[model samples]
Target: MAGGGIDTRVSHRAASYEYKVTRYLIFSCIVGAVGGALFGYDLGVSGGVTSMDDFLVKFFPLVYERKHSHLKETDYCKYDNQILTLFTSSLYFAALVITFAASHLTRKKGRKASIIVGALSFLVGAIINASAQNIAMLIIGRILLGAGIGFGNQAVPLYLSEMSPAKIRGAVNQLFQFTTCAGILVANLINYFTDKVHPHGWRISLGLAALPAILMLIGGIVCPETPNSLVEQGKLEEARRVLKRVRGTDNVEAEFQDLIDASKEAQAVKDPFRNLLKRKYRPQFVIGALCIPAFQQLTGNNSILFYAPVIFQTLGFGSSSSLISSLVSSSALIVGTLVSMALVDRFGRRGFFIEAGSEMIVYMVAVAAVLAKYFGHGEELSIPIAAILVAAIFLFVFAYGRSWGPLGWLVPSELFPLEIRSSAQSVVVCVNMIFTALVAQLFLASLCHLKYGIFLLFACLIVIMCTVVYFFLPETKRVPIEEIYLLFENHWFWKNYVGQRHQDTLAEPEKLGESKPAHA
Candidate 1:
């Protein structure tokens, strides 16, 4: 009878433990999603708000008058192209500066604190933007918004990676990308309605971003700190508690010990950047820090997203039609991101990169061919031809959303050890923003000068990127955080060919901190 009662108690305890873990994991992912949604909202809102007729008339009367003199007043605004460009790209400049600070903030206060700071920053920015009386005020708000993005972008992915089980880490991290798409969809929908409100409609569009920011702040308060950060801070017991809560089981001893071992190795390195350059870690730095983000930006995805309406108009669509088409393209992006979230874990990262790269090359080449043919005609093309061009652009976006959009963020988050994860991620984020700024600044100029050549340029880049992935990038699916170094240690070709199988073999009987043979 005593044995029977003890068995029942054990079963009950196991059930109760699982309940808590599942609850905590869901809560944490929701919090990360809030941060992602805010990021997406910022991206979507700016495009629509700046293009609103009332917004331009209030802010730039001279340019608005010039534009209106040429045609009937319409729903879209016209502003000085230079000023409008500044307004849109200004956020990335600020993001670059604040990302440096975010690295320190994440390390000193912990990832949760950094996330809270980001949420508050975004809230303040939203308020300022909503009440802006001049272009200068609007610019200041954008700066603040960029700062918030800088903080949250670095902290959230790192937190998610640390908290997630290895088996589902890719899917969980991809949630960041998925929520970003959701934010874009939400913002686009809001702006569609708000555009009808004259004079102050832009304010409503910009102000709505605060809702997600507020939710992120509240969620940050409720979520537990990541176990990895706790271990870094030498709070072993706290780390164990967090691991148990997040991993959904009490059998976290091995994982916690792995964290301790990895933490010690990370702490032993005094200068992460200097150490990152060492020959041993070069492959990771090359692939994670530099190549991934550089290739992601160069793909022209952001250029397409930031200037979709303009591109559509250049293709001869009317203003309203261009806006609607941009919305549809953004919807495709959301769908592609959702698909990526579902498949990233199952398909593995390298496969997606290769597939997406190949598809992007095909789509961009086709777009260039179609555009070249239209321009060759020396007259306006028929609507069917224009539709083909739009389809090509949408396909390019779909391919990007499926691969680089999420993996760019996911790869860096998983590549580094705990000691340098935040700093390394911040550096990569800064690089990403820099490239993004460059692309934003140059995209219109490229359209003017290169014409269809721009698509060809992006296509060539894909060819190079695909080659790099096939040669250097290894599969990291289900690999434990500590053992990631083994992936970089093997010969490049061997790692690429047999890396996943080796990782799977090592993962069996999951011994924590167990080192595989260097050549294995």
Candidate 2:
């Protein structure tokens, strides 16, 4: 009788664990990451398009139409440079407003719905940009594109981060950053190949982004809404069903309990945004919504990625050589993102932030010194040394790819509890987009007017970033989302959370004066 009873219990347990991995989750994340690609592609393609005088003349004919009617075609080309600068900068103008709205929209619509909305909006934006007859049309198209990107930017990470197993969360979430680099490489390649053949190649590039948008929309139709969203709607069974598939049965009930607890806390909370200001979560909230993105943009990454070809050209690389270097640089970004994924779970969050931030300071200063010495005023100091300087650009991409690039998203995802994750994510992403726009706008103007002065300014910013990270940042890896609050509530997270085996190297080793294992 005892043997029969044990067998019955085992069979029942196995039966209860039944679940299958669906294709929908994987497909949805890919589709979501594609929106990130469009943002990267558009940013990169504009760099080359901005330099094309003929394309600018054709695209923004209004500027030249009335101002210089009789000038020779060649002379008119020279006079029309002003309009292209304005055209190139229009993207930043649009992104700033759209990102703020994305937070509220995501809160109301849910992740999948917001993504579909963004994709459709992107499709319309691409059509408008492709068919633009005047600068006004172009600006409007840019705004539409910005809206789409804003929605995706906020929605993709939140969905991916939540759905992924915490064990491999960094690896899965890194896809967004990977596709971003891939898009940049694609854009750079298209620009370089079409540079001699088609000045209006930008239209082709802009239209290519629509293909991904369509796929994303289709994917959203097929994928399940996140369990978190389902729960928020009072569909507890539906949430449990989805969780069983994603998380498996080993600890399904326990995991579900945690989810339920988090949901209750979240639902009980009156205003997520206001609650973010509560003393306990406030520091993390500020770090998520402000510090992460600030660290990302202040590293001079935008200055390097967008203006690499220009900087390379100044360093005596032939136009084609500079283009090849951009390809290599983007490839390095992909590789670095992969490396970051490998170490994220191992080294923990704060370690990655501090190490990456400190290293960036070193590289940014070196890049500044190299740019000052090897190239200035559109001239090279010496061809041989300039080649070396051109190669150093890859270092910049690699540094960012490893640290600021992925961590900007990763830190916020890991730092906040389930209740405040979305609110914190929205605020941080909005801050990121705002500063990204500001930095992009200033970077170009600074390059035009300040030359090496931009690099010098970024170098100083990087140093300050390193200081900020070392003093304030907290490490978070392999810890459950709920327990993350313990970091804020407990006085000794480092000592208590970081295991004795890894104590000495931990940032706040003294926190572990008691020296317990990570989980104990």
Candidate 3:
């Protein structure tokens, strides 16, 4: 199903897109990246809210009872109620469905429109969540929040990639992950403080989600549209001006021409989703849209991030200590994103994947082993053992931050050609959200039944996913977004499908890496 002895280690670099990171470029990227914080705030806030005595008592009293009455429940099953889980998972379900609409909006209305829509929807959701009096209102608010996340996630990374120069695409696109981490860290800090605010503390935690939504909304209004999307919309003159402004140079001919060429190819396809099934695109579909997003969740990092406070509480930490622990892990996550941004282009994507995957596997297994040997149901872990577990988790998150955490968004954002970019991103977000929902929905039950075995399962998944990366995924660092197909066409395994029947329908028969005519 893979390489027939074709070398897959080759990495390609195109001539640099003329760029100097001007004010408008930075502003546009910052705005798009801030959208990631909307997502991050929710991720960080939910777990803490769930762990709050006030929230659990209001929405899930049985769970609230279980949390206090340790002897009556097992270590992992304390929060196993599906209704409670649905409070978190329902958002992802909503996000999963809205992704299709976001794809159309991104293509028809431009990426900026989708971001603004997402921000407004998220703000509405946050307000509703803050004022909710019943489970139905809560679920509805979460779904709205998910709608915002779906649209925001679909467009932001693509916006960053399109706006950035090839040389720093990895670093630039990672602004999404960086902001996401910042949101999570900020949320955790807020939760730590809000958790003490008596009966209304949980409402405060959920309500604060509106801050990032407003930030992104403000940023989206002032940021310029991406040159690639502008080109696709046939705004050639305006695209020219934006290109010059963003690049800080008038010599943007090569980059602008490439955008035009890719836009023409994009224009040829009316049904990008249907065209996505063609044999030549099989490689991108399988790797970029499917496997990468799937592997990202199977790494089990999101599951951890989603329930960090709960996981800590289940492991016997006091409520405040659990929030502190989540804060610590999230801090590690931020550090990891910064490291990835600094080193990703220098080291390339593949090396980070394999190396960080190994690191993750080791830590996951260590956590599992420690839990199996030292942690028991209804038992308090010694302070030393508890410290070790937190340390292991911190290191694991650190590894994820540098690897799948950011690359999951970065690689796929740059993987597709302009023609199927929106459609491909839709697939990517849908896969990601569905898996996220599944993990959030089932993790407590899995924890109940599998206990320490859950960590081992993640460790095993890491091994399998890393193997797929080394064998199947090509190195795309420094490759101009439009020229990314070259890496696939030259790859050991992917070349089989990428150069298949799809090329016959194109305007020109130039091999993938060659420059096509701007008019073609």
Candidate 4:
């Protein structure tokens, strides 16, 4: 009868519960979405800023002539391709360093504080980049921006996931992706307008990223902390009040009770770092931290966006024309993210990821083959091939928006036990940022050095990513929040020893379910 009551209660909760998305919740998500915009703006900013030959030649004349300190005015007309590449790619290294450390900082402070730190840093970085008189100062600003990105990358997703209901969790969580595409669009438009309006146009382009940072900082000042974080800190009453405010009075007690259970599990765990190594929690950690985001990067989708101008220009489009084509790809990403918000809950996580990954692998191969054929033959890209390249990039961004982009944030929040959720999630995010930074830096350097071989390298990485997703990642689309504990019970579930372990765990189930998992 008690078990039946629990079932009936869940059904009632599902049937009658109407999420009154409070003003606070909506405001908070919009604020959190700004972080995503900053991400897009920063990535796109470098491509536009560095493309201005006049700006590059003026700002870093030594970049072109290390030996000739006083070159004639006519020397400015010559383009130094290598220095241009360096100017474009330097930001990624800073991103790499910040990503590794953001996890620790978020764990030490709450998500809100960490985000505040990132926002302030981004503001300062933008100023530095805008005022930079030398290449060294510009590099410093990019590093600062990267650190801000690292913090935003970890905190915003954690914030969105904690605040949303399970029914719309996938859609709400994907707000980050949608806003990220929004940021990209904003940056492209800014680039297009600024490039047309001013000779020192790149300064406005670089500085415009500051708007989102300012909004994020102001928003974090008033936003409420995650209920789970509040509960974990033993502020039970405070957690309850927040739940009531965010979730409405329809199920406040049950929600508060769920938070209490999660707090207990969190309290039971002695050490977060060690908890990740334990058999029960390790699988989700690996899947979230290592596998999912890794696959997202290996998709080669970023390569197109990050290097769009150069890549297209190499294929025969003029600088102005390539930026226009890049805008089309950016627009597709926003459209695709909106589609993902609608479908992630309806179609489920497993199908989207597997299908998107498979399709992207084919697109990447075609892109590489086409590029290799043209670049190798010393032939300029014809209109048909250029159109194909643009379409291929569009498909790549579209597929990414639906799959790994948003699920990257959703899975980590859902997969972990309450005890180590924040810390573990932070670690995973940090690792992801580290790799994001590393990949961005290496990609730029590789393009300068390896040329066409760069695509082949990413192609290999994508193959490894495909194998991991097919075998390891589980479907978490409609599973209740509390039930995610099942996926964590055995690290070997992805192995051939699954049925035996299931029997063993079921025979002594009490030890595992002694406490309920947290309400994320």
TM-score of each: 0.84, 0.82, 0.90, 0.84
Clashing pairs in 4: none
The residue-by-residue lDDT of candidate 4 on 1-520, one tens digit each, is 1110113344454554446778767976887688888888887767666655446566756542421223332122223355455555556556556764776666556778778988998999999988888878887888788778877887787778778865666667777778888888888778776766456788889888888899999877789887876776667778778877888664666666655655665566677777676655556777876777666766667767776655665555666887887788888888877877888777767667777777777777777787777653434578888888788878877887778777766666777655676667666665666566555555655654666566677667767776676566665666555455554343245333222234332323333332221211
List candidate 1 segments past 4 Å from native.
Answer: 1-21, 61-80, 247-251, 375-381, 417-420, 478-481, 492-520
Candidate 2's error at 484, in angstroms?
A: 2.7
lDDT (tens digit, per residue) of candidate 1 on 1-520? 1100112232233333332347778888898899889998888777777656788788867755644443322112233266666677888888888898898888777899999999999999999999999999998998899889989988897787777765566677888888898887778777777878877888999999999999999988888999888988888898898788777778766667666766776677688777666555566778888888888899898877777765665565665676777787788888888878878767877888899889999999998898777653334458899788878877888888889888887777777755566557767898899998788777766766677898999999889988887777767766555456556545445345324434333333234222233223
Cα lDDT tens digits for candidate 2, 205-264? 666767877877786666777777777667889888888766554446655655565567
Candidate 3 per-residue lDDT over residues 225-294, each given as its tens digit: 8888888788999999988998999988877886776677667777888877777778788989999999
The per-model lDDT (C-alpha) reads: 0.75, 0.65, 0.84, 0.68
Tell me model 1's lDDT, rounded to 2 decimals: 0.75
Which candidate do you rate higher for TM-score, 1 or 3? 3
- How does model 4 score by TM-score? 0.84
Looking at model 1, report the run of 10 residues with the lowest lDDT sum.
1-10
Candidate with best TM-score: 3
TM-score, prediction 2: 0.82
Model 4 misplacement above 4 A: 1-19, 60-109, 376-379, 485-520
CA lDDT, candidate 1, residue 32: 83
Which 10 residues in a row give candidate 3 its minimum summed lDDT? Answer: 1-10
Write out the backbone clash pairs for model 3.
none
